[model samples]
Structures are given as C-alpha cells and as structure tokens.
Target chain A: MQPSSQMLKGILEGAILQIIQQGDIYGYALHEKLAALGFGDIPEGTIYPLLLKLQRNKLIIGVRRPTGNGPDRKYYHLTDEGEKTLTIFQQQWHQLVQAMTNLNQGDESS
Target chain B: MQPSSQMLKGILEGAILQIIQQGDIYGYALHEKLAALGFGDIPEGTIYPLLLKLQRNKLIIGVRRPTGNGPDRKYYHLTDEGEKTLTIFQQQWHQLVQAMTNLNQGDESS
Candidate 1:
C-alpha cells in the first residue's frame, strides 16, 4: 500500500538519513534512489526542501563538486548526529511495527 | 529504541484508531493499554486531546456510561470512517517498513 503524503511526511526524514548514511549523494540521485526503492514518484520538490532542512538541522553537511556534465552538484553526507538520529529512528520503527503486529493479531480476541 | 514524542505525534492518531477497532475503551484503559504495548508513558493530557480530535473528525464516537465503581466513563468506538482510515494506515505502515528494511540492509552496498 502506497502512503499518502501526510503519512510519508514524518517518516521521510529518517529514510533520507538512512540513504545518506549509505554514501554521499546529490539531490537528484537521492530522488531516484527513493523511487527505485519502491517509494513511488517522490517529486524533487519534496526532496530538495527536506535536504535543505536536514542541512539546517546539522544532521548532514553538503559540499559542492564540479560534475563533468554540468554545474557543480551538492552532495550530502551524514554527520555523527545523523547516525545517532538514524539509530533512534530504527529502534522506534521496529518497536512500533512489533506492537502493531501484536495488536492486530490480538484483534480476534478483542 | 523508545519513540520520542516528536516521532509519535504523527502516528498516534492511527494507533488510537487501531485500539478502538479492537474494542470500545475508555481514556484511562487506553492509556494503560498503550503502556502495556510498549508505547511508554503516554500521558492522558496527550491522549484525551487526541480523542477529542478523533471525535471532532468523525472517525470515532464517544458515549458516557456509568461504571458501577465510579464516575461515568466515556467509551470510544470506531466509526465506518475509522475502519477505513485504519486499513489505509496499516497498509502504509507495512510498506514503509519494507522500504526502510531494504534501505538499511542495502547500506552495505551503497
């Protein structure tokens, strides 16, 4: 089931952090990676602004490098703080999933 | 990892809906159930307000009934709308879990 935009909003930041933690990536590449991973068509409009926010929050750092094909691209990589945040997000996510599973399974009795 | 208040704010509405779907329950019982499910110390100040919002949104209805032991308790039960919302939430949640799982595991390759 695809998520509505509202459902996606809270989880997106953590997804982006997980991606950046893999390796440094540029905005456009990040967009494509999300799509490739079955996230559907997440517009650059959505991702670029989030990247800016992550930068503003000091969870990531961006550096510019000349791309042979065009203008310099800004690449994002996680900071130590980003790693810590991702760890917390992962734990919260797993716990949530487990609890939800138990709740749904127990619905028969309730 | 326990979820922070910020992480939970978005998903709490859905969780509450799931609980109501299980059975009609009052505010205090809902609080205890959440703690039992590992949702950790969610206060009534947080839950009661969300219940009001759900009723306002037409996703749930509340009925006050006398419990032999004490003050009337307001029991919350899901509406048709609540059932629909919970279905969507469950779908979105599972998909998000899959994508996150893939991303984290793929971190080795990226």
Candidate 2:
C-alpha cells in the first residue's frame, strides 16, 4: 500500500541508510533501485530536497566521481554517525516487523 | 549506517508504503515505529512535510478522530493506489536486498 506521507517521511532516512550500508552509491543508482522495486512514478523533485536534509544532518557525506557510463556522479557514503543511525533503524525495523506480524497473527486468530 | 540524503529520499515513499500495507496508522504511531527501528532522533519537522506531499500525490487519505489519551489524531490509511505502490515497493525492496546481499557475499568471498 502507498504509505501515508507522514509514515513515508518517518522511515525514509532509515531505509536509505540501510541501502547505503550495502555500498557507496549515487542518486541515479538509488533511483534505479527504487524503480526496480515498483516506485517508478515517484516524484524526482522530492528526492533532492531530502538529500540536502540528510547531508545537513551529517548522516552522510558525498563525493563526485566520474562514471564510465555517464557524466560525473556524486556518490554518497555513510559516515560513522550514519552507521550508528542505521543500526538503530535496523533494530526499529525488526521490532516494527515483529510487532506487526504479531498484530496480524492476532487478527487471524480472532 | 546513515544513508545519503539522495538515497533516503528515493526510498522513503516505498518504506512508508510497506508500513501502511501492514495496517492503518497515524503520524505519531508511524514515528514511534521508526523510533523503535532506531530512528529516534529524526527531525519532527520533516515528517509533516512529507505527509503533505504523500496526500497531494493521492497515495493516501486521512481521517481525524478523538483519542481518549489525548486530543484529536489524524489517522492515515492506504488508498488502492497506495497499495499498488507498496506492492511495487516491496518488490523493489526485495531486489535491493538481494542485490546488496550478493554484493556483500562477493566482498566476503574475495
């Protein structure tokens, strides 16, 4: 389901953090990842603004790198703070998943 | 790890969509979910803006209800469009997770 905007905003950072924890990546690559997942129509404009916010918060750092396939790309990597945040996010994600699963199980039983 | 701003923005909607797919919830409840996942320090200001954007995109709808413990709360639910979006997101999320896991495995092997 399309999550409410409020919920979307709440989890955006953690999701992104988890993605980056996998490896260094750029905006377009991240967009492609989202597209592959079924969010093809997501508004491109919204992303840049949120990117700026993450940078300002010091959760990530960026570097410009030349790509063989395209122009120079800005690659973002997680900082120490970012990793810590991701740890927290992952924990929360697991907790939320467990909670929801239990909730669903309750519904099924009742 | 904290994800770059760019990546965070790209994935935010999808994560939120997944959460809502689990059940209807409110902003505070959603925030708590994020917090439980380790995003306790997220900025409060950012969520409302994203919620507005999600509403504008028509992926979610909202209702106001009185709470016994507090004032009126705005509850948001996924629309059909939102559900479709979440399906896409979940697929994408799985793909991303698979890709990352493979990448990590490759790194470990090498």
Candidate 3:
C-alpha cells in the first residue's frame, strides 16, 4: 500500500528540494524521479503547486528553458536559501529516523 | 534545531500508538517518553488532545488508575484497531525511509 498523502505532505518539499539539488530538473522529470525513487506516483497537481510555492518562498528559482522540440520547460534549481532549507530538512529527517529507530528498539526489547 | 511542528504532525499519532502498543502509559509519562525518544519537547497541549482524539477514534482506550498521592491518571493501551493502524504506519514509515535513503544516495553519487 502507498504511504498516505498526509504522511507524504510533511516531507515532499524536502524530497523535491533534494532532487533539484542533485541537478536542475523540470516538473515532469521530477515527478518521474520521485516515482523512480519509490515515492510512488505523486500527481503533477501536487508537484507543480509545490514548485510554485518553493519559487514564491525563494527557496528555489525556476527559469524557463527551451526543450528544442517542445514547449519551454521551467527548470528548477536550489537557491542559497533552498540549500539551507535542504540542510535543515536533512537534519530533521535524521532526527526523525533516530526517534523511530529508538522506538522500534523499544518495541523489540519490551 | 527541532523538527518543525508541521513535520511532526503527520507521524506523531503513529509514534504515540507505537508507544502505547509497547505497554500502557499515561499522559505525562507519554510526554516524557516522547521527549526521551527524541521527538523533542512536544507540549502537553499537543499530547492531551491527541490522546482524547485517539480515544474518540477508538484506537486506544484509557483507564483511570489511582496514583494514591495525586489525581487518578488515565493509562492508555492500544486497541486491536490500533494494532492494525500501527502495522500500516510501520509500512508507510519504511517506505518514506526508503525514498529518503534513495534520494540521499542520488545526492552522494551525482
């Protein structure tokens, strides 16, 4: 079964930022990448709006670039603020993992 | 820095249920356990309401027990429904971890 949307909501932005940090990518490719990475099929509806929000927040900046054979694609890359946010995300994610790990151990020991 | 409240919102219930599953626990002790387990300082404001909600949802049942020196404490235990929910939560949490791990690897290899 898929992770509930509510579960995904908290972390999707960080995941998206991490993807963009690796390389500049457009919307469609980002969706594919998330699916490929086992995030499941996240809809474009969810991703596009987040990209806009990220751009609005100035965490990421998007520039329109030609695909040479199709419509212009808006490629996203991390801003300095985005990079910093990504760092915080990583830290928070690690802390979460640690907490879950400890909880699981508690389960095992009990 | 602590994981933002928004980030914690999605998983806190599952974490709470997991704790309850391990054994019966009361409100204040639950808060301390969460803090000790590295969820950070989640306020009683958050925990009490959630316990109420969990009870209302029938995922947990609370029993009032005498403290002898203080007011009775409502000890919480997971219902069968809570057990099923915890299973789903573990699956979802692992999926999230896998996705994050894959993303982290992409960052490292690229």
Candidate 4:
C-alpha cells in the first residue's frame, strides 16, 4: 500500500510540519521519523529541500546547536505562522477525508 | 475547509474514476457531482482534460449519446483497467489516511 510519490508530494509539507511540531528534530532524524510513522522511505533529497522551503516560507525555523557527539545539528521547530498553516492544512485534510469516506460509504450502501 | 488546488489535483483522477464506477456520467454532471460530494467547484477545464487522458490510458471509455434534450452528451464509464487502477488508488489513499491518523493520534496522546 505504498503511496505514489505524486500522492506523497502533495501532503509531505504538512506531514513534515506536523512531525516537527511533535518535537524539534534535525534532518536525518526527521527522515527516520517519517518512515517510522509509515510514510515509507522518503529520501533525504526530498526532505531537505522541503525543509528549506518551509524555512523560507517562514513556516519553520532552524537553529544549529551542539550535538555533544559531533557536528552541529540544525534542529527545526514550527514557527507561529507554521502552526497556523498546519491548522489550515489539518482542516483541509479532514475535509478531503470526509468527502472520500462519504463517497466510499455510498459505494458500499449501493 | 476546501482542500487546496494542489492537494485536490493529486486525488481528482481517483475520485473521478470512483464516481464513474458507480455509474456512467457526463462531464458537466460529473463536475456537479464532485461539488455536491464536497470537493468544491472543480472546473470543467480541469475534468475534461483528465477524462481525455483517462480515455487515452484506456482506463475509461466515453460515448456520445443523444440526450433527447439537446446535443450529444459524452457519458463516461470505467473500463476494466480503470477498475484496477481505482482499486490501487483506494489502497494508496487508505494507506495515507492510516499514516496520517497515526501521526495525529500520536500528536494528541503526547
């Protein structure tokens, strides 16, 4: 039941934001989190650029900090604007789910 | 809670096929049906081209018939290929929903 990349691309940003909202995380950890959460193996190539785009859009902010083990990790967290956008994204997502659920239920009944 | 155009674009084909599977439908009626089903006002400009593509892909077949009101109406129905594709789409959609549901539930629990 792997979702196609096209289907993934549309929702990835919101999913990423939701993940970031869960906790501040660096890129590699975020990639791992998406997989653990059942999004499949989304490449770092796709995740990095989206992270940058979200930063540029002011939906997230990243800050480099000491990792105690090695190189500084740029941890990301949702900004105020990011929270608002995520709320809207959740609403839109739920609405879509509702419509599809209704349609499928109709199919079952008929 | 209208899903963004970008979001809708990814799922429209699957939804259309699902609708066509329920019964034969013309383009205008399809548009109306989508809105009534809560997809909002999806333009005919968007649907007609996708229908043509689906026909080209052999997923659907459209036939022009005398509507007894005015000009010929091209009603569309799902092909066997379309049915297969719709099944796959449904699986992918459900997988996505499952992933998001887990993510949101995780959010709420924490």
For residues A56-99, write the lDDT of model 3, one tens digit per residue: 99999999998799899999999999999888777777777877
Per-prediction TM-score: 0.81, 0.49, 0.86, 0.85
lDDT per residue for candidate 2 within B30-89, as digits (tens), equals 776654443333455766676767888899887889988888888888889888866665
Model 2 gets an lDDT of 0.60
Per residue, candidate 4 scores C-alpha lDDT tens digits across A49-90 of 989999999999999999799998899999999999888778
Each predicted model: what fraction of the native A–B Cα contacts (within 8 Å) does it retain?
0.23, 0.03, 0.43, 0.22
Clashing pairs in 4: none
Per-residue CA lDDT of model 1 for B1-110, tens digit only, reads 22222332367678789988888999999988876765556789989998999999999999999989999999999999989978777666665566667787783221
For model 2, the DockQ equals 0.09
Where is model 1 more than 4 Å wrong at Cα?
Answer: A1-9, A43-45, A107-110, B1-9, B107-110
Per-chain TM-score of candidate 3, chain B: 0.87
Q: Write the per-residue lDDT of candidate 3 for residues B1-110, one digit (tens) a residue.
A: 12222333468888899999999999999988887887776789989998999999999999999989999999999999989978877777777677788788883221
DockQ, structure candidate 4: 0.22
Assess the local accuracy of residue A101 in candidate 1 as a C-alpha lDDT between 0 and 100. Answer: 69
Q: Give the TM-score of chain A, superposed on the true chain A, for all candidates in the order listed.
A: 0.85, 0.77, 0.88, 0.85
Per-model C-alpha lDDT, please? 0.75, 0.60, 0.81, 0.79
Clashing pairs in 1: none
Backbone clashes in model 3, listed as residue pairs: none
Top-scoring candidate (lDDT): 3
Candidate 2 lDDT over A11-95, as tens digits, reads 5556566667788878777766644443343455755566667888899888998878879988888989999977766555544
lDDT tens digits by residue: candidate 4, B48-78: 9989999999999999999799888999999
